[model samples]
Each structure stands twice: as C-alpha cells, then as structure tokens.
Target: MRGTIQNRDEFLSKVAGQLGQRSFTEGVERPKWKYQPQHAVLKDAGSDELLEILKMQCTKIHTDFFVSGKSGLMETLKTVVSNYGGGPILTWKDSRFDTIGLTPLFKQIWPEENVEINEWESSRGEENIELAEKANVGITISDITLAESGTAVLFSSKDRGRTVSFLPAKSVILIPKSTIVPRMTQATKIMREKVKNGEHVASCINFITGPSNSADIESRLVVGVHGPTKATYIVIEDL
Candidate 1:
C-alpha cells in the first residue's frame, strides 16, 4: 500500500511542473467601469427634503426618528429618556456629548444613584461592559447618516466603544443634519478623508440600518437577539 501511494508522487510532480510553466498576467491594466454619479439626485434636494426622506426611510425600517434644533436637543433627550422609563443609561464620553451638556441633565435625572448612569471610560473597561449589558438605554453620536438607506455610521474608539450601541436593550443615536448625506458613497468618502488625515479610526465601523431582527427560525421574527431591540435617532436640525 505504501509503494502504491508513492507512485502518485510522479503524477503530482508532473502537475506542479505544468502549473509552473503557465503564464500569468503581469502589470496588466484593466479598464475601469464608468457609471453615473450615485448621489446626483440629492444635489438639487434641499435640507428639508433630505430630512423628510431620511425620516420616512427610517420609519419604514421601524426606527423612531426625532427632529430637534440645537436649543431643543436637551429637551428631546429628556423626553426620550422619560419615554424609555428613565435610569440605567449608558453613553459615550465623547466631547461632542459634553458640548451638548448631557452630563448635568443625566445627573439631574439620576443623581447619586449607583448603576443608573454609566459613561464610557478608557480606564474602566470591564465596569463599562457590565453597565452596558444591564443598561436599559444606550446613547451614541453618529459620524454620519445615509439618507438613501437610513443607515447611521459609528466609528468606535476609546471614547466611544462598540458595546455601547450593541449591548443595550434600546439604543439612541444623535446625528447632525449637516452630516446626513444622500447615500453611502458620500459617507464613505468622508470617512476615507478622516483616515487619510491620520485620525484614529477604529478597527470596527458600524453601519446600523435598523433594530436587530432575525427570521431564521420557523419564519417567525425575533427582535434584539443579537443587538438592541429598538433604535431611536435624534436628528439635530440646527446643529
């Protein structure tokens, strides 16, 4: 049996020799495909029109969309928290949130209560993860939102961890109207520029379209199996 198997070595060697002699393309330039601009439809669309389209698309996918101005942002956030039944909220510690002055509002709502409010900290990774797992609501600020698909783009980093959006039962995202684009190509172009400028882009860039849903078992739908069951987007109109 050993001698018979060894006989196949010659055949394997012949195959290898034949493969080695094959010529492969070298430095061959292929013509690139040309297509119409993807976001041309949005070029003439006003901000109000874009916002309406985004809101419609987001609602179609079961995401609650709230519109507010810079002055009304805190009030909108408070209303969102109250609607979610308040307390046990997890959020990122990014300065954009600080500029929005959420800390005082959170403290006012859940003052001195242990485990009621947890902010992402670079030094307290394990604690933050535990808080995220148990939190009723998680809040994040999105880098961009795509109007065509109603998708929000989040870039995770030390300031904003991935679990803050994925581990909670309900997730809330704050997006500026100025950052809303017509399609994904524009959003990705902006992200590419950020990466090129030596910004600290994280290994994970999340593009969340809607709540986590699965229809794999028995054609019945289940929500929040892998992530948040519900998502709410607050679009700041006057940012």
Candidate 2:
C-alpha cells in the first residue's frame, strides 16, 4: 500500500510539472463569469414558492409529493409506505428519525411482525446491500433538497449507506422544508460553505430526483431500470 501510494504521488507530481507547475499546491483559481445565470433562478423564492417549484418539478419527474407537519409526519410516512407496498422496510440508522418523532413506526408501531424492519448496520457490510435489495420500500431523509430539479441530496455515511435508497423496489424521501434550495447552484454553495467553515464534507453525495428512468430498449422509456420503481417525497412543513 505504501509503495502504491508513493508511485501514485510520483505520477501526479510528474503530471503537475508538465502542466507548468512544480506541484498541485499552485492550483488554478476558479473562473468568475460575468453572465452567471446559475445563481439567478429562483433567487428570490420564499419557502412556500420553493415548495411549489418542487411540486411542479416532481410532476415532470414522475414522483409523488405530499406536504405534512411534524405531527402528521408519521401518518404521512406510513401512508406512503403502504401506498408503495408494505415492508420488509429498510431505513438509515439516523438519530434524526427519533429527533423528528418518527422512530416508533419502525421500532413499535408497524404491525407486520412477519415483515423485516431493518436498520442499516454499518458493521454488516455486504449484508446491508442484500437486505436493501429485498426491501419493498426504503425510507430516507434529505440532507438537502433542490426545488428546481425535485432532487433529494443525501450525504452518504457508514450508517446511512446509499443502498438504502438505491436498491429498494420503492423509495420514500422525507425532507424538512427548511432544507429546500433553489437549484443545484445553491446546493453547491451549501457544500462550499461547509468546506469554508472547516467542516467534514461528505465524500459521497447522492442527488436522487425520482425512480431511475431509461429509454434503452426501442426508444420506449422505462422506469426503475437502474433504481427504485417508484418514489415519494414528503415535505414536513413544521420540521
């Protein structure tokens, strides 16, 4: 491993020298364009307007959208889960589930004793992927949600693996309305701010819009080809 790293560093240093620099320490500055349209879209949008934008975008992306308060969040989630077809359910081992008062459905309220209620165990490794693949519905909360693209940005970690959202037959996104941004530009800015503030930025981030769609066979579009067959986004207003 040490030798491999040394060889990789040498290769990078040689490439840097060819790029008119002694090393990568002399990095190029980010370009600042005058006609910047990225930051312009929905720049003045309020929370309500953002929600409307997200709702409209979801229509085009083929995703179900719902609005609820913290009190109704559990009922809303259960409804979507049932609508998507009940468990075996898969969810992240996030404390936020308890913080927002939705943990009971997983730990106690869910009535189907035969169905497996699995919390992601990082130690389980490949077992996590196997269970996720078998889940009827997967539930996750958005770290950041883009209104323009109807995208839920989830920062991957050991406990909240990407498979929880990727491998399931159906998926549900629970987003706090406060996290909604205008578009990808704002999402990028948020991450840049985290780095600027010396925070530990996530190495893997998944920007899921809806169920995976593809038109690979005979020009006919098919959903769930690469991911979940159905997706629902529930926005908790009071959260």
Candidate 3:
C-alpha cells in the first residue's frame, strides 16, 4: 500500500512540474470593448425600449412577464396566486413590499387557513430552509434586472434569504422598472460601488436568467431539477 501511494505521489508531482507555477497564476485577458455588438445596441436604449427588450428576451427564455402599476400590483399578485392554485408562498422581508403595502394584500388574497405566506426571517435558520423546501412558490424583490439577458439579480442577505429563491418549485420576482439595467457591466458597477461605500453586501449574489433547467441526463431536457420550474417577473412601472 505504501509503495502504491508513493508511486501515485511521484506521478502527481511530475504532472504538476510539467504544468509549472505560471500556468496556474496567469489568468485570461479580458475583452477590450465596453460592450459586445449585441449588448452595445442596448447601451443607449430608453426605459421603454429596455423594457421591450427585457420582455422579448424573457419570453424567449420561457419566463412569464407581467406589468402592473402601483395601484394594480395587488390584483396582479392575486391573479398570479390564483393561477398557481393558491399554494404556500415564501417572500423576502424587504421594505419595498411594505412601501407598496403588500402585507394587507397578502392577507386579503391568502387567508390564514387557505395559504401560508412565510416572510423571511434571519432568526429562523434551519426552519427557513425547511419552510422554503415545502413552499410551492417563492416571491422576492430583484435589486437589478439585466435587460440584455433578461436576468434578475438577487443579493442574499438577512432580510432576503437565498433559499426562498432556490428551494421552491416556482418563483415570483417583483422588479421595479427603475432597477432595470442594460447589461451585467452596469450591475457589477453598482455592486462594486455598494461595497466601496461600506454597505452590508450579501455573501451570495444570484443571477437568474429563467427557470432552472438541465439537459445532462441522456441529453433530455429537464426543468426544476435544481431550482424553480417556473419563474414569473412582475415589473412595476410606478415603482
């Protein structure tokens, strides 16, 4: 056994020697252009144009998109819940929801006996994960929306746990139109700025393009294997 272990060690050392130290240290060079051809076109687009592009790309990626004003948001959310057969919902404890008065709407739509609405709480560590796993739908607020890729950016923190977006079978994101950006570059810049300003940045930043899907097993496409099977984006125009 000792002889075999030594031989294996010798083989690994030889392989590492051949690769050399520089091979691991040297990183790939970044692209020179600020934006690629596809992304460049969206750089100067107006809010309306960006929204249109976001809608088109989201549709292509099989994500349901809905638009609603501040006044109509409650009805829109009710419709979404009703369409999903009124299951348990997990949501973030963000101020944005309070600003729009979502708590009352939730109470009105989903009564105590009918549906369970689990608002994220930091104190409930393992309990939160358990709730998220059982939750039929997870609802969150998107900090940034990449219009070019139709991606929603979520920064996981105490108020907004990562499990709410990942463990559920379906997800609903409440996105403000003002948070929509053209590309990832703009999003990263904002994140960097927050870090520089000594803000409480989250440990995990999730960039969700659409529903979780994989074609790994026999090349047959499967959805919701690792995450939500369906994702809905509610873009609030008045926010």
* Highest lDDT scorer: 2
Off by over 4 Å in 2: 1-24, 111-115, 217-219
**Candidate 3 C-alpha error for residue 222, in Å:** 2.1
Per residue, candidate 1 scores C-alpha lDDT tens digits across 40-158 of: 76877777888888999987778998998888888898788778877689989888876766666666656654437878998996888998999889999888888888998998988
- lDDT, candidate 2, 102-189, per-residue tens: 8777888884445568999999999999999899989999999999999999998889989899899999989999999999999999
User: Order of all candidates by lDDT, from best down to worst?
Assistant: 2, 3, 1
lDDT at 117, model 1? 81
Cα lDDT listed for each candidate: 0.83, 0.90, 0.85
In candidate 1, stretches whose alpha carbon ends up further than 4 angstroms from where it belongs are 1-32, 37-41, 112-115, 217-220
Residue 58 displacement (Å), model 3: 1.1
- Return the TM-score for each candidate structure: 0.81, 0.90, 0.81
Number of clashes in every candidate structure? Answer: 0, 0, 0
Q: Give the TM-score of candidate 3.
A: 0.81
* TM-score for predicted model 1 compared with the true structure: 0.81
lDDT against true structure, model 1 = 0.83
Candidate 2: deviation at residue 103, Å? 1.1
